[model samples]
Target: MMKALLATVLAVTPVATVTRLSLPPPTGPAKVGVVTAHLVDRSRPDPWVATERFRELMVSVWYPARSVRGHQRADWVTPGVAARINTPDSGFTLPVTHGHLNAPAAAGKHPVILWSPGFGMERTSGTALAEDLASHGYVVVTVDHTHDAQFVEFPDGRIATNAIPPVATPAEEEQLIGKALDVRVTDTRFVLDRLRTMPLARHMDLSRVGMFGHSMGGAAAAGTMLADRRIRAGLNLDGSFAGPVLEAGLDRPFLLLGSESHDGEQDETWTRMWDNLRGKRYRMELDGSAHLSFSDFQVLLPQLGLPPDQVEPAVGTIDGPRSVAIQRAYVRAFFDRHLRHRDGRLLDRPSPRYPEIRFP
Candidate 1:
């Protein structure tokens, strides 16, 4: 779920002075371009906010750019989303990103990777990973599940927020999460269908599509793969299986990348899901990382001057840059081997470069 406000407060021991925050530059050779589209799913009603007539979504597409020389950089979070996430008294300013906004897509049909952020989190929470993949010649599509996300700003200036209320019991929590997962799965499939007919379709190799998500988003990735045959591979970052995939099993390539606190051994859900995998599968854990380390929060939270203790429980004990580097490397490797038909030796064994990572 979007970083829990209560959890953030409980995790942080001492709040530090606010300072300038910035995301690291994309590590690939090519420049990145981003474009946002506002879509409405007429077939479905708003799942969380029942008052809405239809399900509206905001999706950001990041891709390799023809040139970044004259393009404008995008904001890490749009003004509307930032407003909803930050209080008037909060001293934090959202970071500026490195993506060239609305720049022309680079020539070539590149493989696609669809990304979904955690529950209540903005789509931009996955921007770092998306931009990295885009820079490496992948067309990355990140979706903001309207009414499920903390805030989704549409082109017409409407802002949608998570309307699902807090749950009081475990059963209630599970029911809410299950409903959210169903909506996420549908949102993903709808986005893919729309992408296939958009102008960007010319530059996307849809047949080679893959998906990865953080926290609840990761769980949605698994469910999406089960529901949509278009997704050839799926990766879950610190998310547990909460859907039918746990019993039905998956027949395509799947990877489980988790933090020290939860892996195949530590979490029964992971073990159960791992056992159900019927196709090519791999599981690995980052020794010092936490649930949010696989997300942009690994860097963003630290830059916001949140004390290490406050961030560590959620993002883990790993240094922000190191965590991001390991994620970028491994995620790229997984997709490369599965989608691009490349040999990603890094996934085959333990590597000296990231000794903190362990295979199970």
Candidate 2:
């Protein structure tokens, strides 16, 4: 009867082509611990109004917990932010997720995964990746770099919108990337410190931790790993290269997953990082995926009924399900190999199951 029931569940759910790691239909019964922190940096200069304070950021931490019997799930994003992301007829709006809301006392000692989202996107925008990692037994902390992101929503309903940065030109994209990376690295390091001192998180395995992100977040993860040795491993989910990450040489285990447009085992930026990596390194390219494919936008796009051509494809992207699955497998495998010391064949070679991915 148990086997039959499991089979039925699998048959009804949408199975990812990669790894055959089928996920049950998305639901909200699990409770994820969440906390919002305000971080102020003195080194960053406010380009918008010429403020001395470098930057301020709002960060949210999501982790698996033992109980959620009465906890209210957190909103995917604030209503106002959702409206903007899901503009009328834009087909980017996601279904309301009652994810774990503000619950301070419900903390756990799970390993951590620091997430950074794409350019001009909110921290919560990577809900798909965040929630997935949390479900698989990692505490995921995401930060919204005040001016870089659209808006950051905290548990108290305090919303921080993008403060006008002094510089907002395309030429300064790299500058914004650096500023955002600065905020992310600080936020992550602070959180790590806070966790070490937290009496509630005594059970968390501080020694085992990783970082992963899409787009700019991906770049930040690389940069952070180089700066902080606390990070055991890192994964870049289709983010473009940036800053010293390319030049600094990564000595830790890292994985770079790219979309068709950016996938290159020998690209200049990646090649340099590859050459610098003194530890384990792996690279995989998803032919059909695009920049937006790294986030929840992949799953949300189809739900909104937007044709593939309308959304991220103007820049060359893949469909949502495939993109999400590819990410799900590579990330899980990477973490498993490094954090758990598990031998997952998925990381060793390309699988016939997901032919869309190529590893050189």
Measured against the true structure, the TM-scores of the candidates, in listed sequence, are: 0.94, 0.79
Candidate 1 off by > 4 Å: 1-18, 86-89
For model 1 the TM-score comes to 0.94
Per-candidate Cα lDDT values, in order, are 0.85, 0.66
- Estimate, for each residue in 1-360, the C-alpha lDDT of model 1 and write its tens digit: 354742463243333444556888889988999988888899878887777889888899999999988889999888776665555445565678879998888898999999998877778888888999999999999999887776678887788766878889999998988889998999999999999887789999988999999988899999999999999999999988887889988999999999997865567889898989999998999999987787788897776666566677777788988888888999999999999999988898999999988996
Off by over 4 Å in 2: 1-31, 39-55, 83-93, 102-108, 154-158, 163-176, 197-200, 265-267, 312-319
lDDT string, candidate 2, 49-69, tens digits: 465455556667776656656
Q: What's the lDDT of the predicted structure labeled candidate 1?
A: 0.85
Error of 2 at 276 (Å): 1.8
